[model samples]
Target: MASRRTALRPPLVSEPDLPDIVSPAAPRRSSDLRAAIIEVDGEADLAHSTLEQCVLSGSGSALDLDGATMMDVDVRDLRVAKVSARRSTLRRVRISGGRLGTLDLSDSGVHELELRDVRIDYLTLAGCKAVDVRVDSCRIAALDMPGATLSRVAFAATSSDEVDPRGMRAEHLDLRGLDALGFLDVTALRGATLTLRQVELLAPVFATAAGILISD
Candidate 1:
């Protein structure tokens, strides 16, 4: 006789009533001028600058754009080992290619920042506040967002191996097209909205985190 497979029962705990999530607003084009090319090896500050088809190349602590604001910029490649923009802001900025070792935007405020077709080894947005942030068609090895606050953030057609969201707060977090393999801590997703498939995929991890045992 063949053994029968048992179906896993739904959790007995009632689902929390969550409000509707909002999508991030897309960035608006700021200018009709040609983009400027900036290729530097050390720390540079660019304020009220519009760059297009720019390529930044350097090593650790090589680029810092603190208190700088960029609009209508299209950065094609970033080859820096580590880039930090703690207090800078960007609008209608696009990053298309190149591999970044670490990109840190901690304690910064940003609106309408878009990252597409890029590869980041480690991304840190700790203690930062952002709105209308979009990441699409990218591969991130690890993401750290401790103590961060975000609104209307969306991740689409992206793959992240590990995400660490401890002490994070978010509103309207859209992960509809995310292909996440590992979440370092699922407890950080308390106030985030996910699709049905995402919930199904992460149910086991959530159960383990809640100390729920499944018996056959």
Candidate 2:
């Protein structure tokens, strides 16, 4: 019998029923946004802000949410060039149907987060501590996770052009559904699970790393 931990548990995200409408105002420090659409026209400094049960969607050149805390938030249909939430904390957040040039969440603590139907040029979670996260049906040009710690993370029906997981620590990380073109550090996937087709696809890369030559 397979252990419970062997299976990837989906993120427990509560859908937000937002009814309030918020004006396009620059968020102040420690702002509390609830049940509203937080739109960012240009750039908003959302550091130390708390957003609960709200929808955040907009088009902007840059949006920064460093050190912000979000719970039960829905981030939908955002067309941003650069979206950064470094060192932020997120729980029960769902980010879907977004097009972003760069999405950086370095050094953040993320729990029960789901990212689906998003297209990103660069998606990085470097040095992050994430649990119960899922990226489903997304297209990413580059996915970087150096020095990050991931638990019960899975990528379902996702595709990435490049993946760099150097020095990453993962437990119950399932990458069988990820169709990645390249991986920077294959050894960093020690504790992750991959399907036989993925293993066969990476066999040459593994052999190259081991300096093994097969000529038949």
Candidate 3:
């Protein structure tokens, strides 16, 4: 072996491929579920699919199903300019966080019509029938659900300022945290009953809205 002088060795070179940079955020509903039909409820088995012409908002609300992730998976909100559910089935659907400029849920059936954490401007539910519905923590200026049969409807912490609740009916009306129920016609609650606290809270506003005077 020839006498090898200690020579300075060059550093070894290493190479690695780079990964494609993609957004960490989840895919959009229009893109991810383009072909997949999703249910509103958190169930293991889904029976319905193919929700064409349906719009789902991508925001979860406080009034949502328990133990369900409304933020990512509970994406069944329709942000359409005008919604026409003429012959659609929206059962067990947890819809929240969207603007339904005008909604016509007529003749359509709703098993669990959950509208939690939504921003509803004007909604019309004429001839629309639903059961077991809840609208909690929502802000609505006006909502019309006339001619619609509702069973066990609970509206908790919802605000319907300047809304017409005259003819609106609910089996168990939970208007505890509501601010305004004055814009509605008092005749609407003719056949319905209310609680003492609700009556007390609404008395002044009711009298004021009707141009009446309330004294001690």
For model 2, how does the per-residue alpha-carbon lDDT over 119-208 read when each residue is reduced to its tens digit?
999999999999888899999999999999988888989999999999999887889889999999897887788899999999998988
Model 3 lDDT, residue 197, Cα: 77
Off by over 4 Å in 3: 1-78, 165-169, 181-183, 190-195, 204-216
Q: Candidate 2: what lDDT?
A: 0.86
Alpha-carbon TM-score of each model against the true structure: 0.73, 0.90, 0.56
TM-score of 3: 0.56
lDDT of each: 0.66, 0.86, 0.48
- Evaluated at residue 113, the lDDT of candidate 3 is 64
lDDT score at residue 202, model 1, on the 0-100 scale: 92
Better of 1 and 3 by TM-score: 1
Candidate 2 lands at a TM-score of 0.90
Best by lDDT: 2
The TM-score measured for candidate 1 stands at 0.73
Model 1 lDDT per residue over 1-216, tens place: 111242212112111122243222212223212333455444444433333323333333356565556555555566777766666666556666777788888877766677888899998889888777888899999988898987777887999888888989877676676788878788888656677888899988999999999667
